[model samples]
Each structure stands twice: as structure tokens, then as C-alpha cells.
Target: MIANTVRQFARVQQRRTLSTSVPSGVRYGKSFGATWLGDKGAWPVIGIIGGALVFCGSFISNKIMFHPDVRITPSKRNADIRDWR
Candidate 1:
């Protein structure tokens, strides 16, 4: 998409100040890309917290915003029956 094209152009326009060459004796590290399933450290806790947040959000919001909204209603003292509708 356009995002990739913009990233490509931005990278091409960037200047390097230091050599990025790796040491000759160093072997290539892990080849796998990151995923939620593969994550054993933070992902599990993050997912539980995320789910809990979604589940509890409405309740928390309603409690925090709790207020009684008053509305004027037609009554015999101030309003005629014919004008009630």
C-alpha cells in the first residue's frame, strides 16, 4: 500500500552515520517473526488485561458517569390534558 511506498522513500532519503556491518564470527540469530501466540513473556498478561478491560469498560464508565437526568413532564397543575400529546 501507500504506507510501504512512503516507508521505502523515507528509508532511501535517510543518511547513515555509522557502519552497520556485523562481526565476521557472529552467527545469525533467530529467524522467526514475533506473534501473540509465540510470545511467552508479556503477551499472555497483556491479552488477559485487554480482555478484562473490554469486559469491564462499560460498567466502569457507567459507574463513573452515574447521574440522575431530570426531565419536565406534562401535569394537571401546569399542562392541559389536550396539550399532553
Candidate 2:
């Protein structure tokens, strides 16, 4: 339909000349592109932000729930006298 006509027109334009001289014994089309974030040190900032969000969310859930004042009975596997007063 109309899509095929636009694709054919674009293909004609892609055939324009664009080249660079290659060194002797060097292979072409064997390279890839990369970003510029290498050697940068920003991991601490990212980790702090993520950890703060998780802590805030946990605090909010503990503060605002359907049964905030109710005591939850522990399951048999997790029930230990030392965990209770």
C-alpha cells in the first residue's frame, strides 16, 4: 500500500556515497559503538537513592496499614519465645 512506496523511496536515499580509507590488512565492519560512562564513579549516589526509597516505603507501610494496632500471631515455624516479651 502507501507504506511500500515510502520504504522504496527511503532505500534509494540510503545508497548515497559515504566511505573512509581502510588501513592495509585491517578488517572493516568489525567494530561497535559504546557510551562515555566508563571510568566514572557515580555508584554510591545511585545506591544511596535506591536504599532511601526502599527504607521510606517500608516505614510508610509500617506507619499506615489496615490493622496498625492489632498484634499479629506468629506462625509455628517463626514463633519463638525470645522474639516476644
Candidate 3:
């Protein structure tokens, strides 16, 4: 009895697989995210994107806070107004 039930479930699963067809571009793409990796199977891609965003945000914040490019001091704008020195 159990064997028959298991076989019937297997047949149903096989039928489902045969009936549904993945899109060509989603199935076959250059990157993992472009393909099924992020198409039907998108959990991994979501995790990757989330982690990358967090890391990138922290990196950018650190750069902005710790390393400032322009140091605005009290320098006169028209101190050296001579033309072609």
C-alpha cells in the first residue's frame, strides 16, 4: 500500500515537471542572477544582494566620515585675483 502511494506521488511530480517550461532567457543566462539562480530559485540571490548592500553602505559611510576630500578653510575668494600669473 505505501509503495503504491509513493509511486503515485512520484508520477504526479514528474507530470508537473513536464507540464511546466522555464523561459529560455531565464533558464540560460550569462550570470547566476540572470539565470534560474535568481529566476525561480531566488533565495540565494536575495541573500547575496542584501549582504552586498549592507557591506557597501558601511564602506561608503566610513569613507565619507573618515576621509573628506575638500578641507574648506577661511581662504579669501579674491585674494589672488591677478590674471594669468
Candidate 4:
């Protein structure tokens, strides 16, 4: 009786393993942004906007880091050093 039950259990497990149903026509590769914004004629506009944001960010960061006045005033204790130059 135990052997019959084990055989039935094995049959049920085999059926469960072999009966997996994956839906057809499903896309796994496309991005959510591509789907939302659409796959047609949207890339150039996105590229231009992304490029502008990068350019503006770099320009602002450079302006803050390398401006001449910023280089002259390193700290409060070094204020007198400016007079030597």
C-alpha cells in the first residue's frame, strides 16, 4: 500500500513539473521607459535632453570648483595670504 501511494505521489509530482505554462507573446527585453514613451521617434529627443542636462551639470560644477575668487579664499585663517599676492 505504501509503495502504491509513493508511486501515485511520484506521478503527481511528474505531472506538476511537466505542466508549467508560460504565456506566449510576452516581451522580456524591452524597457519600461521605451514602452511608456513609445518605441518610435523618441530616442533623439531623449538623447538631446540627456546631453543638455549633462553639459549644464558639468558647466555648473566647473564654475564652482575652478573660479578664480574661490581659489584665492581657501579659508578664514588664510585671508591675509591674499594680500601677499
**Model 4, total clashes:** 0
Candidate 3 off by > 4 Å: 1-40, 68-85
Better of 1 and 3 by lDDT: 3
Could you tell me the C-alpha RMSD of candidate 3 in Å?
14.7
Ranking by lDDT: 4, 3, 1, 2
| lDDT (C-alpha) at residue 71 in model 1 | 18
**Most lDDT-accurate candidate:** 4
lDDT of 2: 0.57
Lowest-sum lDDT 10-residue window in model 2: 31-40
**TM match of model 2 to true structure:** 0.32
Q: Each candidate's lDDT (Cα)?
A: 0.59, 0.57, 0.67, 0.73
lDDT of 4: 0.73
Each prediction's TM-score versus the true structure: 0.27, 0.32, 0.35, 0.42
Residue-by-residue lDDT tens digits, candidate 1, 1-85: 9999999877866633224655564545634433444568867788899899987997767755552232144243454333333
Sorted by TM-score (best first), the order is: 4, 3, 2, 1
Cα displacement (angstroms), candidate 2, residue 50, comes to: 0.5
lDDT at 27 for candidate 2? 47
Residue 48, candidate 1: how far off, in angstroms? 4.9
State which candidate, 1 or 3, has the greater TM-score.
3
